[model samples]
Target: MNDSREQYTLANGRTSINALPKVSLHDHLDGGLRPATILELADSIGFEVPASDAASLGEWFEDSADSGSLVDYLATFDITVGVMQTTEGLTRVAREFVQDLAADGVVYGEVRWAPEQHVAKGLTLDQTVEAVQQGIEQGIDDARGEGKTLRVGQLVTAMRHADRGLEIAELAVRHRERGVVGFDIAGAELGFPAGNQRAAFDYLAQNFLPVTVHAGEADGLDSIRGALFDGRALRLGHGVRLAEDIRIESSDDENTFVSIGGLAQWVKDREIALELSPSSNLQTGAIAAWGDDLQDHPFDLLYQLGFTVTVNTDNRLMSNTSLSRELSLLSDAFGYDLEDFEVFQLNAANASFLPLDERQDLADTIIAGFQSA
Candidate 1:
């Protein structure tokens, strides 16, 4: 799926969606590595891969991730994290990750990954962060040389099943002035509530660090509640399940009557961003309550209710998509137009972990891009 060459045009034929400036909020570093890069890095580390060729390896990843069960889908990350042990491998993968995002027309992106999973090759926590920062800087320079301006920040993540929450939190705060911008918790979200990482959340809160939790994906409103009350999360990663809190009483051709639950009201009133990744949600069964198709996803309902909904590609390689493609898919499913697309971009830009001034700049860039489009 060479999505870089795929261009989507609007019905008006006035703009190519791929050329529009975009903001990526929920992308994963480990999950976005190039298939060829993974092969080369794995060979360098003498790590055995399931497939020998790059094409086959790419298919293998897509197949492995397509499993409906979350556990089976997560098993695929073992291979990616296995090869990302050394500093060189991490740096190369990070660098190419930015290059790929730049080619996909992402002007600003937050790359999330769990550092604890990359300690197999004996690199210290600080060293691993430094290595990834170096690669991001190199990738930025490369994008500049190619006449594309891109900025990326690291959203340091802690595995929910791991006991290193406070440790990873401190590491993120230590690197705040470097490339790290925020903190997140990912993994099985159903059983491992954000409350389990109270110490880390406390430390991050006292330090005034921004947080986003992987909630409302594999779990329900209770998990989202924990993310807000315990994790103090500023954003919800794949908070698609928050739609469960929205109860529809009746509807007509003119309007739909609905009632909002307390949790849903707070999230909507507070304007917490929902990182909705359409394809990934379908593959992971996150929207199984609604249906197995994009059209059945609650993304349209949430957007209609003004939930600060932002489109994303959770894992570009695994989901085999990009932000542009995600936007295209959403537009196709929900019959959204340029105005709706621009709203999604603006929502992501405002919800980014960057400083207020930087976020303002990002918004300005998006406005300019859409104006020209």
Candidate 2:
């Protein structure tokens, strides 16, 4: 919506990363709404927005989110969730979300959102899921008509601080056959540990549902440990701070020695994916311990250590980013080549919540796209 065509190019002028196939595993449905769409939806619902014009509204979201305070950053979601309280609003936003992903060359995307946050307009949970499914189907059809094939699935989320985890987990399982692919716990990751939702995780585990928890972003190793042990999270949402587990023992001009703590070792040995969002990590202070620059991110260390690291745009609207822009920024910060970019996409494909066969298909798609490029 913000001329992403101009924003998503390789740093070294290698190629247009936007044209490469990608997998989006940690994106947020509520956080990816277009500014114009938000304005229209808010107007129809008589909701107040912080800004009147589309551009100003977009800037407001970025600025609010960039305030470096988690509470301040999360306030931007109030306006988005306010507008997305109806079936019509949810459907339109979901449809455009898919279209935007397709336009950005995302072969597959998992749109995560807290359904509990969207119940203000009195729509039942089932109705909200169905509305989003309808929009996803429409988006797929639209992409097919335009000779672009893209697939999207919903990752139903339960707010971590809320008491609806068990209900939301059941809702995800009930709709798994329709459009839902996975479960996640989001919102205020500091004091709200995943252990509080033990019943939900237990239910999901019994039902064989995959989960990715938002940990290690606003918290530390204890939170990540809870996500793995209590939530049984197959992946970590913005688990960038897991780098804290690694201690740089020594460094030289040629190489640096590091010691991986047990937590980092287990994550690596198990091949659990870290859904690292470059821009959002910076905006949310997830990488504050490392440094205040993109180059300071531990993405390189994690990648070099064979962590199953994957790139994502956690909140495209809030961060004013896309998957392509994320890859581009990583390349600029770390001097990564096309092969490195391909590996990130492949890692994402392998880590997708899709079944094994579909994951294989996604990997093949990424290989073909990269080969062509």
Candidate 3:
């Protein structure tokens, strides 16, 4: 269990909301490695870590990630990926990632990671996926042993900063029958447009594979446009920048009139899920155009405007957060209670890459858990 995932609750005086079932759609597998696990993995490889002990190393990650720039914040991934090169390291880290999520009460999760980053230790791309899958299976059984039931899917991600999109996409499709569920383009989102990976997106479309693109996080609407149009992304990784298209025409105390641009209207009407990570958004300056705090995030506006908004922790270790903590912060910032949190979970359940029947099952599980809560 990740002791860092302390119990959290809504301000409405409910019991531990952390104990309530949740879904994670945009979490990263490589980005959620435990500090102690990294230390152990690095030691076996004779690799040097920034901090000596787990406690200090965890603090170093948290401090380094608060740079308020997505590019700078992503620099911390070097250490996490450094330790995750071998099959054993990948499997162990993935196992612990699921265990941590299960401990935090996540019933369902889709973990995304770029396989290209893990080949340094002579493991083939397919071998890396299999390793992580083995760990996920182990984690599930371990969680069940401790009376905590959880399900996880792998979203094979291609780094947008690199040129292996089509190769990685093919890898994801090859592993679909094994354990993979979806495909994603991650890493630096700006400059590296989804259009750069047109071949990969086209191949995925031909194969009818599900895709979710990292857009509107470090970039603007054009990137999101490419994600939807060029990449045919089923969901936006962090489409908070879609708010840029919303024109607040007039406002008053009682109500406010607004006009959403064609793109914003399209996303809202199409019910595209905005996988918004509140603290990460603020830390990485994804919401800097609005303000510098959670209250300033377009999440509230997007949620109020009827856009499909779902809470997530994009990188639990880098952001030092979990789905539970994200919900607590959102609740505090927006005065949300259990009902609002339930709505977010329902939105995520509907937007999940799971099949119709499985999505319905997840929704049922979420509803039942929230009711029990």
Candidate 4:
């Protein structure tokens, strides 16, 4: 497990970040597996791993992912996805995923993974979804036993570089009533645009299914434009690069003047949440144009500009981070406090795939938790 998973407190030490209610919208299922679990699963499948012990293996994932390239960062998934080709592997990893989220104080989470990737071991798409749903259910029960309440849903993902977009979208709609809450297109964002999956997006639109697109991370504004125009995304995963559209015209001691592009204004006015993962964004070079440090991230700028920004851990093991750690890092970088954190949780809850009533209920729970804390 990541050492960052330890409890984090506000900068002033007034509140415990781990004790605050949070929501995670962009976390990846395969990317959040525990290092110890990876070792066990790899051993059971006779798969070769780079390290023998959990600590070294965890460090290997973090170190390898530190390269400032999205492709290089994504290559670390080969080891994680390699051992998750069977029902046992999928179920166990998923169960532990929720347990970890609960431990991190995430009251609601959406776990996204490409089902097409897990069918390499002969399991059908439906079977893989079923196995994961089973694991999620068990994990919920386990959390309840531990005196925590966690509600999680699956976000079925299609590989953008592959030809299974339509199939994966259909699978997601098929299981909407079971456990799959929404659909997404992830992987290799530079070359493959969401428009490439036009048929799948059309079908999802016709079905009234919510969609979140991975845009503005590896690619630029054109990719994000395609995601908004063609994919009809409800949220933008790691849309940190949308900051590229905002131009600073002039700055003063008291007030700074800037111009927002049409696209940036639209996303802001529409309240489309930008799922911002600080450490992962840094690791993948998503924020390189701005700077190489957390303080340099556009997250504070986006928030100050009235954008719907939600914090997330895109990949826990790879980034060696958790939701609390992400919040803690942001707090330290921007000097945020409890009120700022509460707004972030509220944004995520409102942007979640859950129905309107449930979202309100979640917002209420978050407000109550923060108030009590």
lDDT of each: 0.91, 0.91, 0.91, 0.95
**Tens digits of per-residue lDDT for model 3 on 191-286?**
999999999999999998899999999999999999999999989999989999998865566576889999999999999999999988988999
Winning model by TM-score: 4
lDDT per residue for candidate 2 within 1-373, as digits (tens), equals: 3534544666567677989999999999988999999999989888999889999999989988997666677888988889988999999999989988988899999999988888887999999999999999998898898899988999999999999999999999999999999999999999999999999999999999999999999999999999999999999998988999999865566576789999999999999999999888888888998888999999999999999999999888999888888888898899988999999999999999999999999999999999998
lDDT: worst 10-residue window of model 2: 1-10
What is the Cα-based lDDT of residue 262 in candidate 1? Answer: 95
Q: Which stretches of candidate 1 lie over 4 Å from their true place?
A: 251-256
Per-residue lDDT of candidate 4, residues 197-313 (tens digit): 999999999998899999999998998899999999999999999999999765566676889999999999999999999999999999999999999999999999999999999
Q: What are the per-model numbers of colliding residue pairs?
A: 0, 0, 0, 0
Question: What are the per-residue Cα lDDT tens digits for candidate 1 across 1-373?
Answer: 5454467766676678888999999999998988888889889878999999988888898888987767777888988889899999999989999988888889999999999988877999999999999999999999999999989999999999889999999999999999999999999887899999999999999999999999999899999999999999999999999999999865567676899999999999999999999999988899999999899999999988889999999988888788888888887888888999999999999999999999999999999999998
Error of 2 at 241 (Å): 0.9
Model 2 RMSD in angstroms:
1.5
Deviating ranges (above 4 Å) for candidate 3 = 1-4, 251-255
Per-residue lDDT value at 286 in model 1: 93
The residue ranges of model 4 lying beyond 4 angstroms of the native Cα positions read 1-5, 251-255
- For candidate 3, the 10 contiguous residues with the lowest summed lDDT are 1-10
TM-score of each: 0.97, 0.97, 0.97, 0.98
